[model samples]
Target: MAFALPVWLAVQEELLAYGGEVDPESPSCFDDFDDEALFQMFHLTRPCIAFITDSTRIRMKKVALKKPTLPVDAMVMVTLNYYAHGVSSAAIQQRLRLSQNDCLSIICTVSGVIAGMADQFISFPLTRAARTNVALKIEKLCGITDALGVLAAAHFKIRASPYEKDTFRSFVNTLGYTSVVSQFICDSDGNILSVEKCCVGSTFEQDLWESSFKGREMEDELHGQYWVIGGSSYNLSKHVLTPVSEPANEKENRFNQAHAKIHDVMRITLGSMKRRFRCLMQLGFAQEGSLDKKSNIIKACSVLHNISKKFSVPPPPVVGKIEPLHPGRQHSVPIQINPEALKARQELIDCNFSVASSRQDPPSETVTEEDL
Candidate 1:
């Protein structure tokens, strides 16, 4: 990830040339410059700085200043801009008055340096004590009651659909999460005395209730079948379950139900798919238009229109003209379609038609033939 040593050296030289000093109190400090100018200068020099800092001692030894290449200031400016905003080189070039090629070069070099240095910033897995501390923090923030030497089981809900509704169930006999839970218990100081290891078994209503109420007490013992945990402002109710047999058939059924729900949402809702397609199309058009400055807006619109037609969706409406509010000036407003209108149109399409096809002809029907 480290940039070439020469690139780093060049960046430092550029910074020095722009009345910038390593020390903050120096006569020629970066503070003397305006924000825009400082930003521009930083954008130009950052790549070289990253390169030099990230390079290993062995790599540094090989670097030489003989053949000077990309300016340090330009590389730094591009790199800083990229990190600040996830914009492409072409956009940076237009805004900064630099050539697209130069912008691209700096971005690539800085990216290489960042990639090399990524391991230094990435966090490692927490130890047992650290994990316990995290749990303690969560409990304190959430105001949930905790008991010492109690078994803690963590569960994850598989998303049935990306849009609308969250479905969660007790995870039983899952290898990975179960293993993690076991590790947490073993590592803790006398938290879990013993574990009842059971093979995947069928799920029963009683088992669900027990699982829900294991560590916590029930409020109403007779009719109160659920466990309530205290939240920051209120209590959250969790249904209790008894241990259930995990059968292959039951797992398959659950999986099918989840899968079917997702499929129905995606296929049946035209609004969902239409919105996704429109957003993607707009992004693609923007990228394409930015790359080729001479690209005609009309051509881009036509292409999008054709694409929409192919999908049987209506094209965005065109605004015929735009006039400037002030007279005798070149400044004029740009016309664009309203996103809300587009969404409404998509919703209408979704509600108007069913995705499933209807049967047209009957199985047993006699047709009258012409007299031959």
Candidate 2:
């Protein structure tokens, strides 16, 4: 005698036969969620979600169809939900009414597609004119003349595996958690201009900067014209401005305080990104997934961060810092200070921040008739 198919299998077969159609504006659909609620669920508004689906539809459709798949919007939602919540494929399987494998495949495919769009949203000003524009905008915003951006590093924790012991170890980071390190250069408005994520946790921040193409270009091509504000842990170079190790006087103290504006912008940028895409706070992975996969996912989220910022998406509720999986294993590296760079910094402060230069001309001792 023939046996009846399982209920779940029956539903799956029925869904496939119908050629999935997820209504975009139905009350039950994501459109039903107000902007805030939608952002809470997907970290993006409905219009932004629509834009992503429209942009990726052609390529997404090009993927070989081994079986019936969800609509493009549904697939995008699945991936975004995964990113916004840091939940596993299985966690979203039932809600989306798809198998875990399908959810996983959609997540990977959509991630790769979105990651390919990075050049559209993220870029560094390469030309002198472009760099000058960025510098002007930053100066207008933060009062730091000739400032290009803020250089900062962020760590995203990952799980330890039996394999790749050396590469994924947490010994290098102060938090003592296995992580992937990302270096970002953000402008005064918290827009990311350059991001490098090829390095692992054990890599020193200075080495990461030194090895980057943008860093080298700043040293060779853009040096003496534009500078990025960085923390003391970074090397002091012609194109990098680190705060005074010990402020000797009021001028130096004021200079350090101004330098801090760009640094604070970087922190806000990184924090906003983490808050938008919670997955980056603590990346989870399947047993079959590798570090490269995690990297691609992070790259995709970076692109999404730019898009969300462009559309003025609201940030989600603030979350506490990611607890270190391997605490009490702090490490520090000495910064190689450059004495020559000190002269440049001093000249900058003397010209722009000195008491005489900053003070007004006693409000024009001889007042005009209009003033009277």
Candidate 3:
């Protein structure tokens, strides 16, 4: 009779094979990839990867426990690959030669580490000097004088969940998938200034904004010195500007055109982020955890996206229409406008976006629709 190998021996053989394939001590396995290859695989350049690894290494070391600890760089690579591609965890485990537990642990640990850096990477300009600086950048880019930032929302698709199933389902008939909506505010250079916690896809952008901490205090915070632009779906306030419903004259048309240029900043910011970390396009997080965890993963992706911008990483090419950040299926109906806000918008148009104003002081850069 043939003798069978012991179960322990089989396990040991598997461990030996994995050890041979990936040396836990040497993370230089990444050195084999060129700049393009690294970007293609992880959506980050080598220098950027190094920066992230160094920043999060200390925290990761504290949490590590099990044997065959992965090098900090290797852990970073695994996590980044997970973010860049929303592939199954099994695929990552197989390719990286890691146990299922190890792969999941690395992803969770690295994600939390990156997300913790949000306060550093993601912030809005609240002071007068800072707000003025942002306004200047917006003026230089699109001639939208006194505009500090742009606001919009995107629907991030996710798997079905038993909790809040009705709320997660897309309210619109055209979009049949379940998703969570996230709001973003970005500056003229497409740098994200702020991101809100994820809400159900069924939530209206205006409702989502109104319920946010920032939105509640925005008018008081601005004190009429600066204005944040948003779509017609949002309520018009003293510090918020929305597009004119029907252009009665050439000046009104000019105002809308200039408003569109600034608005594209948010769109480009959202699109580039989704392209870089495709997990946002189709979030793959397990539904068992608190919803906050999923939201943090999204936040972590935005933090990484901002870091990529700091490193001058070029965005991936657009495949088609830049994914719409405005989630409303149908155009929003015009709401009652605040008298003060209406006057402010009119004054803004007459001063900066009028036909005469355009002739006197042209925009520094003319952004074509195709450019977006």
Candidate 4:
């Protein structure tokens, strides 16, 4: 017959009683039960002992055989936490009891997987019907009939650079997307309207200004003009706008102020663009060509010329200013005229000569016969 006793009592007597803490009233404290009796009691419960032993062995085997799955999810959580909270990786490692190598490995692997998935997911070349529907939706949202115009203006500030163009091109190429940057115009509601390649250059300031003027009823009423000036490292564009109602004397003053602002903005933008371009070149996106000071100057002049033509503005003088270091030295030297400026100066000279000759002749002098 199986000994009728609780396992709890046997365990308490075997383990807890050794600590000198026991209750005399407890069934486990029975003085009548010797070691043999207690052994017999526990032996009678053979199935329970076997079950406990098997469970422990199975757990041990699982712990030994289970492969480390990189704890990818934990790594992602840590990385995101670090980025979002600005916590150091060392702090994260300490808290999570993770080694630096393991943390970095998980982060790199997870990032690579996410990048691959993003590359795989974004499909391009949306249908014409889809584009039309998108445009219609944009129009409704912006409450404008020319929703595309709104879209263009919104993106004009963002996609105004050649760098942005190249980036978009690369992204599209990588994803096998057929959507051209030009095809995406911003609508009044800031929604991208329709896909068309023409939209790519629409964000450029010159393009936007020209389009606005052309679309407006009075093109001549627009007061502003823009020009490019100087060479690389100091290349700039100057914009001058005169209010229609302003007095003639104030026109020059307003122009000077506007030109200064234009110069400041262009200088900042060009410097930033150059830095970013250099970084891209280093990263293998751009070819390592001659970006010497002379080449930079030429490119700057070219960009200015192109921008001026697009806006129907005369090209500004691309002259480099050289300031004298000492007061005793001569004044700053003016650089040579740009090709466009030279042509303009020549035209002005020819026009003045013609005017003087016309005034002198004026059909007022007739030759008389000298022999008579």
Candidate 5:
């Protein structure tokens, strides 16, 4: 006969011995004995954990030791909690009963593994068939036609270095914190198709895009028939659209009104993304060799966002506003012009007024809001 261990001690041992995958019904130290508690702990459901574990287990497996430092499930659990809460390594060690070094190592390793596997879930659909499906869904949601996707950028808060060159930001000086800005392009359903990461705090969405995958290429690829949209901060082009600056006339006013519909779409999606991964709320301080670790975490969050959306996991409430500030680029290079792109922009404007005059919602939701 033997006495049962204390509940807390037993749970600790169970977490330490955690192997294979979690059973959804089984108890977990990460949360109370409830579904909502589990969701709150990791921002992921049981199935979501299993889904990711299956893909990442190969890399996570440690063949060198008969008994690993931590079980694979425990490693993933600790990592998710670290990213989800943005806690210190010491706090994590205390919670999970690991050394400070082990806690730090596990975070970097597991975050890298998740980012490496991003391609499996996060993707940009290049085919007409795939794009068409996205366009249709967004149209129903936003009441705009021919929209490809929503483009938006939100700054993730990070602590600046003491020397501070890497994290310096003229824009957010008043806010008193630095950031590693990331830009995201997502389908109407808020699935990330592309990500631009590791940009410093001062970089605005416009400058960021010109240096990214969408800068000049979208015009050539979109031509006149398709379009993407963005906010007023973005300079409008043939393949892109923005709200009228002052609404010089009724036509422009109507265009601005139409732009609002797309704005709501982007707002909802970006809000959902930020809310789900609160770790991104303030990604802690930036220090030497810590940039890559944080960048990988951002990518992993995006991948997890896509997964949660796919499995019908409800997105958390959208919280916070986008900071408004664009000092503009310091020095400028002249942007080149293309005749076809000019024609396309004109056609888009005309199409906008036509819908406005008709007093009807467009058949498609091509009203996107992004530079790229």
Candidate 6:
């Protein structure tokens, strides 16, 4: 009787407190939405939601937690709300009825997981032939010779570090606040090929760029007739081609013209990314947390960006903060250019001229991407 009394009292309390039952004519959430509407809300197709939930479950299987805790679907829901809407944890808690800490944990965990799946989300072409394929696209779209991709740095505004004074001395002030910087390599199609984060805001872009994996990879992967484009920030190298400082001839002038076209494509790509995930666009991440949360947010966004492109996910409203055109000039950077690299660059310059100059087949020393 005592046990039954407790159950009866609980049921009475539930009914009395909530005004009959909690049921209603409609629920203001994904439950009532159609497939198209669901994607608009979640930024994920139904199949993608299932795949992510399945992946999260498989990853979390080793960790034993209380049974009454939120299921993997809810965890993913918590994470998706941030990517889709860039809402605060409190708002998510109110909307989804989960704790703020739960949302934080889920975001960090899911981001870290998705960040590691770069191979699946990013299209990093290997083998010379594969690279040539990418280069060909640049030629088709931007009319640049043997161009593989465009390189740029993206800055995310973070909360002013408690060590604001110390950071001032240590880093570039991102409009009077601490910020994080990541280097991006994107193909002609606006697909992000590589994203290297974890650098402090003050770090000089050229130095940060050189230390990146893509930097070293550029040295080895590109050879005779292959190169990537960068802004004036990067020093010219065997594999990297930057705009000419002073156009000595019509050929150099023409190269800059083609360069601007390709760089514009990169700008469009960065703009679309921030518009799709507004969190990176605004400034409200937890100030105390290490860049772990912000970095993961960005990492997850990158993956989702790829997923969006793949599935044709419509982007949110666009308000760009990442400038597509680059700053910093090359003359300011002192260069001890490698003799071989210098020679190679000249050959490339001459090669571009030949392509620009004539319709005849390019000499063996140069590669005309049109034939490829």
lDDT of each: 0.28, 0.67, 0.70, 0.28, 0.62, 0.64
Residue-by-residue lDDT tens digits, candidate 6, 1-372: 012234334544544453433232323244555787766667667645554554444435433334426655667777777777777446558767767676767677767766665655666666678688888888765556777788887776655546666654443433444567778888877778888865556666778677888787777764445677888777778778878788888777666767776776667776777776767765453333366667667777887776666555556555534454435323454777677766776676677654564432222332221211
Give the worst 10-residue stretch by lDDT in candidate 1.
Answer: 178-187
The digit string of per-residue lDDT tens for model 5 on 210-248 reads 777765567656423456767765666655565666767
Q: Model 1 off-target regions past 4 Å?
A: 1-68, 71-73, 88-98, 143-372
Off by over 4 Å in 6: 1-31, 35-40, 44-68, 89-92, 169-177, 221-225, 283-289, 319-322, 325-333, 354-372
Weakest lDDT window of 10 consecutive positions for candidate 4: 322-331
Off by over 4 Å in 4: 1-69, 86-91, 120-125, 143-372
| lDDT per residue as tens, model 3, 1-372 | 001124223433544544422233455646868988888888888867765665555434444535437776777778888788765346546767998668767877778777876776787887778788889878776667787789877778777655655543443222666667777888877777888868666667778777876676686664346788888767778877888989899888877877877886777778788888887787754342356766877889888887777777777777888766553543367677789889988998887766545333353455533343
Q: Find the candidate with the highest lDDT and give its number.
A: 3
Give lDDT tens digits, candidate 1, residues 209-239: 2444332333333323222221111111232
Q: Compute the lDDT for candidate 2.
A: 0.67
Instruction: Kindly indicate the candidate among 3 and 5 with the higher lDDT.
Output: 3
For residues 1-372, write the lDDT of model 4, one tens digit per residue: 011134324434544433423343433211233644422322112222222222222322333424335332344444333322223246557756878677655544433333222111221213545335433543232111111222111111111123655645432321233111121222222212221222321133233333542223113423222112111212111221211122244333333332232223223332222221221111112221212222222222222222222223221122343111111111135434246534442333344322333222223332111100
Sorting all predicted structures by TM-score, with the top scorer first, yields 3, 2, 6, 5, 1, 4
- For lDDT, candidate 5 versus 6, the one ahead is 6
**Candidate with more favorable, higher TM-score: 4 or 5:** 5
Compared with the true structure, the alpha-carbon lDDT of candidate 1 equals 0.28
RMSD per candidate (Å) reads 26.4, 11.8, 11.2, 31.4, 8.9, 12.4
lDDT (0-100) at residue 368 of candidate 6? Answer: 20
Judge candidate 5 against the unseen true structure and give its global Cα lDDT, from 0 to 1. Answer: 0.62
Residue ranges of candidate 5 with Cα displaced over 4 Å? 1-33, 58-68, 88-95, 162-176, 216-225, 287-290, 317-342, 357-372
